[model samples]
Target chain A: MVFTTAVNFIRARGPDELWRKRRIFKLAAHFIGRKRNCYSIAVRYVHRALVYATKGRKLKKLDMKDLWETRIIAGVNEHDIDYRTFRESLYRSDILLNRKVLADLAAWEPYTFKALTDVAKRRAIDDGLASINNEHKVDGIITRGALTKS
Target chain B: MSALKRVQQWATFARIWHIYDATWQNPFKSAEVVKKFLMGLYKPIYHPLNDCGDHVIIINSGEIALPGDEWKKRVYFHHTGYPGGASWTLAWELHTKDPTMILKKAIYNSMDGNLQRRHTMQRLHIFPDANVPKSLLDNVSNQIRQLRPVPTRLDRYTAEEVASYPKLIDYPKDYIIR
Candidate 1:
């Protein structure tokens, strides 16, 4: 298509209006009633849906973190260790593991998780960071505090 | 699915009954541990939407220990939907009223308040004493370990064992009279 003047060429939209509306209509296909058929209405709902999708993506991560924390708490509690102590002990021992991996270990690899908790418990007891009520005695664990006392 | 695979699948999803001895255990602390089994959080296949919870039989709830002065300080509140029908019961009073009520409330409050809360609670059986029905006991193949070691009371210890116990220092004869 040729424009008669420079102004006419500038004013002409690059793509056909039909194609522009089709993009939005494609997304709104599953939507009900006028929102699916009408271009103006479809565009509004599509924009809103896209916004929700964007927000949901972030929310999904937060929700998963919460879930992993819950699972880790449950796993730690099973071995009579509090979640904070377990994580702290692991960190102090230089056994770096993220919550996702820890949660996975707690669920699918329970025995491995138990071993990890045992290590954590020993470390916690040695460091004197364990809860008083735990009262679990770990053999062969000596810390700076004990060495200085002796 | 193949026959062996079918059996494996059934085993994966099968509900297991677990027994927990709550004697000398802190009810509030035990509730946190019990909630996991009740909700099947220990299972790898656990999901909020999934029906993968297990049945938990809690025995000797009457023997549950309250930390510090909680037995007298902790209050359980209840209100009837009428004018001035509210009542607050202390932990000890509530325990005396119903041995299982404190533990039951602890487990109930431990979980998130949702539609599933009540349903999940249905799987928990709290017996005041170790008097659970044989039918329920027959179903239990696993025992949930207590969170803390049960203390041996002075009266519960054997006289010979107590006498043999090593002491750092002996009390003076005159000081020991009290």
Candidate 2:
């Protein structure tokens, strides 16, 4: 029975061969159209699917970054600093805070975010960013950074 | 207000503007401002994907003044998608046909060519004069500054100022002979 040892089973590696190429067919069972039914078609689709899955890993990072910036911008409007002004102020003051952390603070810890906004407002005012909406006569709640500057 | 109404109001931060076009500005440049306003870029809440922009009520479009010879030079072209269906029209002619067309076209062209542009255009309400619907006028939250100061009109001159205007030369009684 063991005349050829493990080499005897090597010749039986076709579609019906258990725990071998058929395993790939099992994984590709849910694929669309001929990709699921035909063994030859399934091989090509499975390769293509894996390629797409790898590429999506990089794309997801950029998409999340854009989303975080948008959320941060939505928060900035409430505290009287527009997105451009807030970003500029952070750059000028060397805050080095990323948009993800900033968005978290804005949504969860609003007071902390407002404090940061006030800091940006003061720096932007000092830099004379023309569109910073410097006429804060109405809001009454002055940003803390501007208060510290005075 | 009902809960639904309250939710509706909270969803949109709609601010109405009263923009003026006294001196005719280059539509190419000024239309960008209109597009920005419609897209809510003036607000911190503005996101390219979101419909967070405000309504714009442009007034005094009838008095829009043109600079240089653009009135004669600028032309708008169109095609009917058939043989020999191409046509061209000057800016002034379009403006005459519909007082709002010039500003509307300017705003339309300045916006990005996409589906969202149509929604933004919907928020822009242009009028030939200061007349606006009562509902819209009542909702106006703020007034944006006019584009530029129009030159003082001759009719606005006082009698005394007109009579005292400096003269280069005083013509004699018989000065008409020349």
- Model 1 lDDT, residue B160, Cα: 95
C-alpha displacement of B142 in model 2, angstroms?
2.7
Strongest candidate by lDDT: 1
Q: What docking tier does model 1 reach?
A: incorrect
Clash-forming residue pairs, model 1: none
lDDT of 2 by residue, A1-150 (tens): 333667777864455445555776887888889888777788888888889889999988988787678678767867767788888888888999998898777656655677788778777776778876556422333556556655
Model 1 DockQ (Cα-based)? 0.20
Q: Chain B TM-score in candidate 2, rounded to 2 decimals? A: 0.78
What fraction of the reference structure's interface contacts does model 1 contain?
Answer: 0.25
Per-candidate DockQ values are 0.20, 0.15
TM-score of chain A of each: 0.82, 0.70
Per-prediction TM-score, chain B alone: 0.90, 0.78
Off by over 4 Å in 2: A1-88, A92-94, A101-117, A124-150, B1-25, B42-50, B65-68, B147-178
